[model samples]
Target chain A: MIRALISRIKQGYRTYPFPKKEPVLPERFNGRPVLNHDKCDNCRACEKACPTGAITSQDNKVCIDMGKCLFCGDCTSACPKGVIEFSKDYRLAANIRKDLLVSDKEIKLAQAIDKQSRRIFGRSLKLRQVSAGGCNACEADTNVLTTLTFDLGRFGIQFVASPRHADGILVTGPVTENMRLALKKTYDAIPSPKFVIAVGACAISGGPYIGHTETSNGANGIVPVDLYIPGCPPHPYTILDGLVTFLGRR
Target chain B: MSRQLISIYNNKSTDIGAVPNLPIDDFRETVINSVNTGRRIAAFFGLPHDNDSLKLIIVLADDHQSILHLASTCVKEKYPSLTPDCPQAHWFEREIAEQFGIRPEGHPWLKPIRFHHSYTNNDVWNRSANETILPCVTDFFRVEGSEIHEVAVGPVHAGIIEPGHFRFQCNGENVLHLEISLGYQHRGIERQMTTAPQNRLIHYMETAAGDTTIGHTMAHCYIFEGLASCSAAARAQVLRGIALELERLANHTGDLGALAGDVGYLPTSSFCGRIRGDFLNMTAILCGNRFGRNFMRPGGTAYDIEKSHIDDLRKRLNAALKDVTNAANCLWSTPSVLGRFEDTGILNKQICSQLGIVGPPARACGFDRDCRYNFPSGIFQFKQMPVATWDSGDVFARAYVRWLEIQHSVAFILDLLDSIPAGNIQNKISAMSPCKIAVSLVEGWRGEICHVAVTDNSGKLARYKIVDPSFHNWMGLAVALRNQQISDFPLCNKSFNLSYCGHDL
Candidate 1:
């Protein structure tokens, strides 16, 4: 026991001081993309290059849906005019669906929880996570928050076993057709006044699997979403930041 | 048994016309005889040939000879099943029935693999003609007796894991039988890939099993490159090998930690948990994404390793691996952890080989079935790593094999990082030729990932079949749980770390 303790003590502090101090995101980390309309040639390469229909253009206008973005940086390479470049800014979550679309000057931010929600479940929050049709990347990243490094427990956020104990439903995957009923049942099982947070591009807008008949085009088609965090599988820091932001801690 | 052997080399694509189409019985005998002679089914699926019939294609891998045999036969709505003779084809036969709506008559436990509707109008099970199908609604194997108990756990699990259902028959805490029912996470990946536009194909492959982004992507790229007759750069192959090893390192490290967590060993578990991230972050430094997404482009890699990235990766890998060694060694030394892990969830060599299991779990059972060693491709052809194994065939063996892999993978990556050849990162690939079938097997973190793609007359996909290692190993997990204490299920499960989406796909 002493050896275990001694070994642990020698290892020193492992948790990142995020929100208190800036999160240490690595170099070449794929994050939120920024598009320059002026440089875009309207070639539609990004639309053609994107596996998911996240990039759409009309009348020489270009828009990228964060909810559907995989953050693969395929768009930047496909565009000949250098219209798109992914930035390290990982704050891509939003409360509303329309807020996910980014063009030139529109940068949608996630709004804080309402006063009634804060009053009812302000001190603590519990989540019941379900992966309807995810690739496991989103699930793995979400689970990473519980580790010693991320330590989501310090923020009083816990993933409970059953929906009855959950304050909200944290959903992953593109919500496959087969899982639609189960997603609805899981949502209905949760107590009323509960919110749903869609994590990853799959849960938000089906990610790379948007057009396949198997998916219901993400979590929105089945249930109304309260928060949208985007990435193919959002970085653990990004997920943590999104949770904290939605909780009104930042 | 008297029929002439028809075969093809691994990683080689051949014209579909070159493969002889034997009679149905001949095909069945060929498959059964091959298995009896010690060959494993690499992939077995149906390809839509015409409006009236479908072609049943069988790929058998002879690991000893480093050769793969391919043969096919046309089958109508009903055909004789080979599952009774070759148990390895059990899931594959069920899958053919589910996908092509063909019945493999005479199989003992034949049921819907995914519970999805047939691709064609033909309904194999004759489910009310046009009635809709639901996933996980199936009649499972049951044992009825005094003190008999059944526990059905489902599509929605308590842990933050992929969705799958498992039914267990138990008297007291000992599990008599375990049946895994999946397809909750099925995304119609195969159907989508049949007509997939060239650019979008890699994306589907990358997402086929998200955790296996590198493995699946490599297999898809190999299939396309083989069909298109394009070769990746020498440097690109090395980098791919590096990325593949890195992925194996991250996942194996994580699985070891998870195994420790299941046994409530917090010291090693917590340390490995953090070290796993360090390995993942190293991949992120090489490419733009942590999971190596968009980095494994077809014909080559999407990103190139720079001097800075290589130096940085070396430093992080050395540091992280040192900590990982310390954390993992604690598990072997701790008497309590050893007691819990050893002698639990045992699947001997015979059962493992009979099930056609692959990856570290198979290695734990004293079988040398690693695709990287038996059937070398890409960088594996140029370099080799020793096969890691253990004879115990228990949870401890599984965990030990993973640790062995982690060390080898880290050293392989570090060595490659030092001597990463400088060259072009990508090569242009053309559209595939028509009427040709291609097979690519990748040693994914989970196990052998088999992807078979056949092109139509117009150079479009005629049929695509993916066999994830999890598809074979899930049964191994079930077989291992036989007569095991029900509480040890999690520990056994973590040792395998099978992918639900991969199997469902």
Candidate 2:
């Protein structure tokens, strides 16, 4: 125990100063994307290359749904004209599903929830994470949120074991056919005035497994999702920022 | 050496014509005899051939000779089951029956491995086509007595984890039998792989089992490269090797910590958790994704590591290695942790070999089966990490073997960082040859991951089989649970933390 304490003392602090201070992310880390229309021609290369239909071009207008975008950067690489590039800005959470759309109009980041939601779940939010068909990358990042670096507990967000204890449910995976019933049961088990936060491209959209027929497209038809946090598996910081965006808004 | 089976090289595509079609009895005898004679059956599956007949293809790996034996036989309606003789054939046979609706005659304990409608019109188990095959609602092997009790868990677990059901027939805390029911996470991956190597193929490979992104992706790429008769550049192979080792380091470290967590050893658990993230961050340094999703492409790696990147990786790896060593050594150094781990859920080597367990679980039982050493592919062919093993086959053995491998992996990665060759990152991959089968085996962190792809006449995938390490080890977990204390199930489970989706697929 003394050796452990000594080791701990030597290790020092591991938590990052997020929101209060900017994070020094890895050099190659992919976060939020920025689109440049001037470089884009009518070429549908990006649309063709996109695994999920996250990047869609219609009527000479291109839009990227942040909920569906996995941030895999295939669209950026597929575009011969170099139209799309990702920025390090990862604060891409939204309370409303529509707020996640990055279209020709404007990039709509995640806004705060309504006054009623804030008044109820603003102080302490307990989440029951259900991995319907998640590949566990999302699950891993979600788990990472609890670590000292992210410290989600500082914000009064905790992942409880049971749905009865949760204010909302964080759903991952593509909502496979087999898990559809279980997900519904889990959602139903949670009391009224609850929300579901669909994480990752798989939960928001079916991701690469979209057309596979095994997955239920995504979590859309199963339950009412309040927030959409997207990534192939979103970064830990991204998940933290999403939670902060939802719960921190006054 | 065998006359009936046509021998082929690993990662080399064999011509459909070269694989001889034998009689059912002869095919069964060949597979049975070969398995009895020490060679393990790498893959066995039914692919449609010869105008609607189910053509059974068998891949046997002669680890010592580094040769893979391939043979096939056309069977209609039913064929003699080799599972009664060869234990490893049980899962593969059950999978074949589930997928193709084929009846394996005289098979013991045959049931749906993955509950689904068969590709064919005939239903093997004879459930109505329109009815829903409920997951985890199967006939579980029962142990009924005056004092016997049953414990059923998950498909919906308490923790933030994957879904799978476990049924334990217990006699007051002692587990009589453990029946694991999976398929909840199945996304028809093999069915999806039939039309693969597409723009999105790599992503699918990476997500097949999320934790095993590098292992699965590398194996799929090997299958692609093999059929196309292309080898990745030496630099690409080295990068892949580094990625694989780093993945190994991360997972093994995580597992060791998880073992600590299960034992309620908080310090090592907390420290190893952070160190695991450090290793993941190192992988993210290479590719932009922490999971190494885009790192692996068909012909070669999607991303390249620069000198500066290599230097950075070396620094981080060194720091993480120190932290991991400090944290993991606590498991062995502290007597309390060892007390909980040692001789708890012991699986004998004879049972493990009979059941055909792979990866660290097999190594823990002293099987000496590390694919990196035995079946060397890519960078492993040039450089090797020795087989790490322990004789106990207990939780301590499993945890200890991982710590040993983690050290070896860190050393191997550090050494490779210094000496990785410089060349073109990728070889030009042309279209694949038609009517060919190729196998790629990688010793993933979990164990042997075998990916077999059979291309059609038009060079499109007709069939693809992915046998994840979990597919081999889940049953072993069940076998290990026999006569063990039921409360220790979680720790025993953490020791062999098999992938549900990998097995479900």
Q: Which digits, one per residue and each the tens of the lDDT, describe model 2 over residues B239-350?
A: 9999998898888888887888888998888788788889999998998788887888888887889989999999999899888888877778789899999999899888
CA deviation > 4 Å runs, candidate 2: none
Candidate 1's displacement at residue B402, Å, is 0.1
Per-model TM-score versus the true fold: 0.98, 0.98
Q: Measured by TM-score, how close is model 2 to the native structure?
A: 0.98
Per-model DockQ against the true two-chain complex:
0.77, 0.68
Docking quality of model 1: it rates as medium
Residue-level lDDT for A7 in candidate 1:
62
- Clashes per candidate, residues 3 or more apart or on different chains: 0, 2
Clashes of 2: 2
Residue ranges of candidate 1 with Cα displaced over 4 Å: B1-3, B128-130
Residues B290-376 of candidate 1: C-alpha lDDT, one tens digit per residue: 788888877898888888888888899999888888888888888999999999999978988888999999999998889899888
The digit string of per-residue lDDT tens for model 2 on A99-216 reads 7777563566677777877888887899999888888889888987876767778888899989899888999999988899999999999998888999998888787788667788
